[model samples]
Target: MIWHHLFQPFIEFGFMRRALVVCLALSVSTTALGVFLLLRRMSLMGDALSHAILPGVAVGYLLSGMSLLAMTLGGFIAGIAVALTAGLVSRRTPLREDASFAGFYLGSLALGVTLVSLRGSSVDLLHLLFGSILAVDNDAALFVCGVASLTLLSLALCYRGLVSEAFDSAFLEVNARRLPSLLHGLFLALLVLNLVASFQVLGTLMAVGVMMLPAVAARCWVRTLPGLLLLAALGGALSAWLGLSLSWSAGLPAGPAIVLTASLLFFISVLCGTRSRLADGLRAFFN
Candidate 1:
């Protein structure tokens, strides 16, 4: 009966099945990216880039009303533009990279909100900000899956370069020459793509939570990169399942529910994880 209660909603509803599939795909793909982001200390960059895509999404909505193709394209273009511009400003000017990114993203967020308020209804704006995973149709599912597939493939192809870049930028730059810059750009593109895909399911504001939280949680337990990636993916998938179940049983919104589940997992890991500082301190105190 417990199993029935957990499994029945997905079995009976097509949307639930689709959400599970999409969320699983997201978990596997985005969490892998998150691992690299965490190791590189660019965790907050994901949050900045998430907001940076807003103006583009708004522009897409203005042009085509809720057309997925238009919005996705717009968001991707905007994200890439902001990333590149931030990099350029940081490199050419005296401003720090993080500061450049923050300024650009904040401005982009304001522009996006203003644009959407001008032409779109409150409901439309809410949909863009909060997403409606339970209402996802076939086309959106396919798009999300396609992005996930590309993300995994790209990660595989760039694994060595990404690992090198994350751990030793100076070594990578000295030994590999242009490889460091190339890899940075490639990684940024992939990050943008993943964020765009996730916005369709988790909303732009909350998408990075799904990406970063699981990886942070996994770090508490795993020291090796491979182990971290594996555990983070598992964490994301588990969050998807538990979040969807809670949403169904309690009439909660799906997006926040899923992210909240990930947050819960993060806190639990911090408290009980063997490698966590809290656990280490407690052990030393007890002994």
Candidate 2:
């Protein structure tokens, strides 16, 4: 009975099956990246970058009217451009990196919303903002799976550099003059790619929630980097499964349901994780 309740949806419906695949893939990749982001104190940067892609997605929509390929390319371009621009501003000016990111993301988000509003209806805007995971066509599924695979592979290759840079960036800089910068750029590229891929599943607004929330929740439970990565992935997978189940049973929007599930897990972690390492880590992160 319990088994049938959980397993029947995927077995009976192709859309449900595809959603599960995409969700699981998305869960693993995004949460892994989220661990790195959290460690780097760039947790909210995922949120900023997620919004920063809006203009490009809006542009692609204006040009192609819902062509996934076009939107993905445009989003990638836009996200990368914003990341680079923010980095350049921080490097050249007195402004801090976070401030630069905030300014650029606000501008990008406004521009995107305006562009979307001009050409697309409110419904279109809603779809772009919230996503329609149940509408996963074969093309979308393939693209997401490919992105997930690429993300995991890239993370594997860059693991050492990422960790070294995260914990002791100056050490990495002294040892390998250009490696830090290269890793930073590569990491940003991967971040943008994952955001783009996630936009397909969870939309731009809610995408980073799935990425960061599970990682944060995992942090509450574990102290080690590997433990955080593992727990975050499992949390993400749990959110995907539970969210899909909730949406299926309640007829709620799948994207928000998934995010809400993550949020629930975060609250649970907060309640249970008092005095845990997460409290100290978060304090340090914000400070």
RMSD in order of candidates: 1.6, 3.9
Output the worst ten-in-a-row residue range by lDDT, candidate 2. 271-280
- lDDT per residue for candidate 2 within 121-148, as digits (tens), equals 9999988888889998899899989988
The residue ranges of model 2 lying beyond 4 angstroms of the native Cα positions read 274-287
lDDT of each: 0.93, 0.93
Please state the error at residue 40 of candidate 2 in Å. 0.4
TM-score for each model: 0.96, 0.94
Worst 10 residues of 1 by lDDT: 1-10
Among these predictions, the greatest TM-score belongs to: 1
lDDT of 1 by residue, 156-207 (tens): 9989989999999999899989999999998999899999999998889889
Clashes of 1: 0
